[model samples]
Target: MKISNETKVGALAIVGITLLILGFNFLKGNKLFSKSLVIYGTYENIEGLTASNPVIINGFQVGTVGKIEPDPDMRRIQVTFNINEDIRIPNNSIAVIAPNPLNITKVEIKLGNASDYLKNKDTINTVASEGLLDDVMKKVDPVLYQVNKSLGTLDSLISNVNSVVDQKAKRNISDLLANLNQVTASMVQSAASLQSMLAAETGSIAKTMNNVSSITGNMASNNAKISHVISNLDSATGKLAELDLQKTLNTLEGTIKELQAMTAKMNSGNGSIGLLLNDPSLYRNLASTGNKLNLLLDDIRMNPKRYLSISVFGKKKTAEPLMLPQPDTLNAPYIIVDKKNN
Candidate 1:
C-alpha cells in the first residue's frame, strides 16, 4: 500500500509513544504481559514510601507499590501494591517498610500460616519499622540527655566552687599545700634514714642483724646438746606422767586429816600432852614434886648414913631416920627444904 509521509510519521510517533509508555511502566516494575495481584494496606505513616518502590518476599523483589493515598475517614494512609499472580499471599500476611543496604526502602512481605489465601484487593496487615538511624537515635537520646544534664551540673558545680573559693580559702589551700610539701619532705628524709639504717655493712639495724645471725649460728652449733637436754626433759616428763599422783595426794590428804584431828584433840585438852600443855594445876604439882626430890637428894648427900647403913654391927642401928628435911638455914645443904617438913 502506498502510504503518505504524514501517515508514516504519525504511525512512527504512535509506535514511539507506545514503546515509551511500556518502557516507563516496565521501569516502574509493572508487568505488562502477565497478570498481577493487587493488595491494599493501611498505615499511619508511610515513612517516605512512594510508588515504584519494590515489594519483596524474603528479600526477593516480587512487585512494586502501585499507589499511596490518604484516607480521611480513618485518618490513615492506604497503600496499594501489585504482586505476581503466581505468588500466594496468606490472609494473615504482614507488610512492613524495611530498610536495605543500598539505602533503598522496600515493602517486605512476612508470610503467615493461614490456610486460606488473600484475594486480590484485600488488605494486608502493615507495620512501620524503624530505620537504623532512627533506632540509633532512640538509643542515644537518653545518653545525650544524661550528658547534657551532667554538663549542666558540672557548670553549676564550677559556679559554686568559684563562689566558695575566696581569697582566704585560696590562702588556706596554699598553706595546706605548703604543709603537705613539708610533710612530704619529712617523709622522704625518714625514708632515706630508714634506708641507711637498714644498710648491710653499717647502722644499728645491721649490727642487730649480725648479732642475730651469730646467735643463730651458736644455736645451730649446739643443736645436738639441745636435743639431748630436750630428750632428758621428755624422759622426765614421761616418768612424771607415769607417777600415781592421785594416790599420793590421797595419802597426803589422809595424813593432813589425821594431823588436823590430833590438833583438834590437843585443843580440847583430852590427851596427856594436851594436859601438860593446858593444865596449870598439874604444872604446879610437878614443880612441888621436883623441889621435894631435890631436897631428898640434898639430905642424902649431907648425911649418907641415913640412906645406907653399911656398918657391920647388925646394920649399925640406922641413924635416927631423917623423917623430915632440915630447915632452910644458913647451914642447910638444901635451901629448897620446906620449913613445915622441918
Candidate 2:
C-alpha cells in the first residue's frame, strides 16, 4: 500500500481530534452523545468545590456541577449543573456541591409542582444545605474561645484544691487511721472479758431456774402432807362447828344469876357466908395476932437457937403459955398498934 505523508498527517490529526471530542463528551457527562438535564443552585461558601463535580439527587448520581460563579446580587456563589432530561426534576428540586468524585456526599431536595418543567439552564432555587469542613470550623471559633476560658478557671480551682490537700491533711488522715486501729485493738482485747461476763450471767440465770425447779419439786413432793393437813383441819373445823358450846355458855350464864343471889345474901348477913362476911371483931383479933406473930418471927430471925433449937440429950426446950391480947373484955374496940414499939 502507497500512502503520502500529508495523508498520514491528516489521518493522524483527525484521529486525535476524535479522541479529544470523546474525552470532552465524557467529561461533560454525555454518554458518547446522549441527553441529560440541567439544574442550578447557589451557595454562600464554595470551599473546595469545583466544576465537573457530580450532582446527586438523594445519593444517586443524576448530573454534574458544571460552572461556579459569584452571583452579583446575592453575593453568593451560583452553581450550574447538567442533568438528564428523562429524569424529570420537579421545579422545587435543589442542586448541591458534593465532596467526592465517586458522588458520595449528597444534599436532598423535595420535588415541587412540575407541569412539563425544568429545561436547559433552568435555575432551581436551593431549599436546604449542608456545608463544607471550613464552614464548620468558622462556626466553631467562639465555642472554642468559651471552652478555653472555662478550662483556665477549672485548672486554677484544681491547683488550689491540690495545694490544700498537700501535707497536713495527709498527717491528719494518718492519725485518724491510727486512732481507728487502736480502737479496734482495744475492742479485740475486751472481747474475751465481755464473753466471760455474758457466760457468767447466763450461768446465773440457769442456776436461778434450777433453784426454782428444785423448789417446785419439793412442793410437789410435800403435796400429800399438805392435803393431809388440809383434811385434818377440815375435820377439826367440823368437830368445832358441831360442839354446841353456845348452849353450855348460856347454862353457865344462868348459874351466874344464882351465884349473884347468894352473894346478895352474904352482903345482907343472912347465912353462913353472911356471918363470916359480917364478923368485923374476928378480923380485928386475927389481924392483931398476925401482927404479934410477925414480931415474933423478926425476933426469931435475930436469935434462931432461942426459937428453933432443941437439946436432944435431955430435950431441954419447954412449952411456954403465951399471954394473948384480950380484945373481948375491952370496954372500947381498941385500935391495934404495931408491937414492934413494945
Candidate 3:
C-alpha cells in the first residue's frame, strides 16, 4: 500500500530528531541502554575538569561526569556523576580527579570498606590528585633553576676570560709552553744520561756490593773471636776494678805531699843543693877552692919534693901533709893565667 507523503515526511523528521538526540547523548558518554546510578561530589577546585569526562573505578570505565556547578556557598564546586547501576558505591567512598597515562583527566572512585551503599544522588567525598603535568613541573623546577645558574656562571666565566686575555698574554703563554717543552726534553735527556751512567757503573756497584757482603760474612764468621776478645777485655777491666784503686791514690797523694814538703825546704835553702843554688857567696867560695886545689895539684906535679921527700938510700921522709890553701885563709890569688899571655 502507498503511504501518504505527509505522514512519511513527519515520520522521517521524528526519526531524524530521535537519531540526533541519541547521537548527541552518545557523544556525551551517556549509555542509553544500561541502568545507571547518580552520585554527587564537591571540590574546592577542579583542575580543568569538565562534563563528559569518564568516571573510573579500578581502571575500568563505569560512568561519566554529568554537571559541574558552583555550590550555594560559592567557595566549593559540586560535581554530579552517573555510574553504572550494577557497580555499587560504598557510602564512605571517595571520588578523586586523577590523570590517566594517556594524559586524560578523569574522576576515579576509590572503593571503601563501608557495608552500606550510597543511594542515588548521595554525596561522595572528593580529593584533588596531582596530575602528571604537576609532578613533572615539580621535578623540573629545581633542574631548571640549576641549569639557569650554570648558564649564568658560564656567562660570567666567559666575560672574565675575555677581559683578562690579550695578545701579549697569549704570546707569553705560548712561550711558556715552549719553555716547558724544552725543560721536559732536558729532563728526559738528563734521565737518559743518568740511566746510562747507572748502567755503566753497574759492574763496579756489584763489586762493591760483593765486597760489602764478604766483609759482613767475615764479620759473622769472626763473631765468636770478637766475643772472646771482648770477654777478655771485660775480665781485665773487672780485675782492674777489683784492685785497691783508692789505696793507690792515697799512696800517690802521700808521695806528692812529701815531694811538696821537700820542694818547700829546698826553696828555703835548707839542703846542700838549695844552698848551692841560693847562696852566691858559697858558689864563689867553691870556685875559689876549686882554683886553689888546681894550683896545689899543679905545684905538686911541678915539684914533687914540695909535697913528698923521698930518700933513695935512707928512710923515706913523709912530706908535710900537702896543705891545700883554703879560700878564706889563703892570701895569694889562685887564678891560673894562660901560658900564651905570660
Per-residue error (Å), model 3, residue 294 = 8.5
lDDT score for residue 164 of model 3: 89
Residues 1-342 of candidate 2 have per-residue lDDT tens digits of 899999999999999999998998697566666766666777786545666666666667777767778877856888777776767877765554445434444444456776766778777867434455556788898899999999999999999989898698999999999999999999988998899898879988999999999999999999999999999999999999999999999999999999999899999988766876897655666667766775555555545667777766765554443344334333434356555643
The model with the greatest TM-score is 1
Model 3 C-alpha lDDT per residue in residues 1-342, reported as the tens digit of each score: 999999999999999999999998899889978867999998887777889899999989999999899978889999999888889888988999886567667999999999999998889989987768788999999999999999999999999999988999999999999999999999999999999999999999999999999999999999999999999999999999999999999999999999999888888998898898898677777766677677676567656875566667876554554445445435655654333533
Model 1 C-alpha lDDT per residue in residues 84-123, reported as the tens digit of each score: 9999998999999886556777899999999999898899
lDDT-better candidate, 2 vs 3: 3
State the lDDT at 276 in candidate 3: 86
Q: How many backbone collisions does model 3 have?
A: 0
- Deviation (Å) of 277 in candidate 2: 99
lDDT of 2: 0.72
Per-model C-alpha lDDT, please?
0.86, 0.72, 0.86
Write down the RMSD of candidate 3 (Cα, Å): 23.3
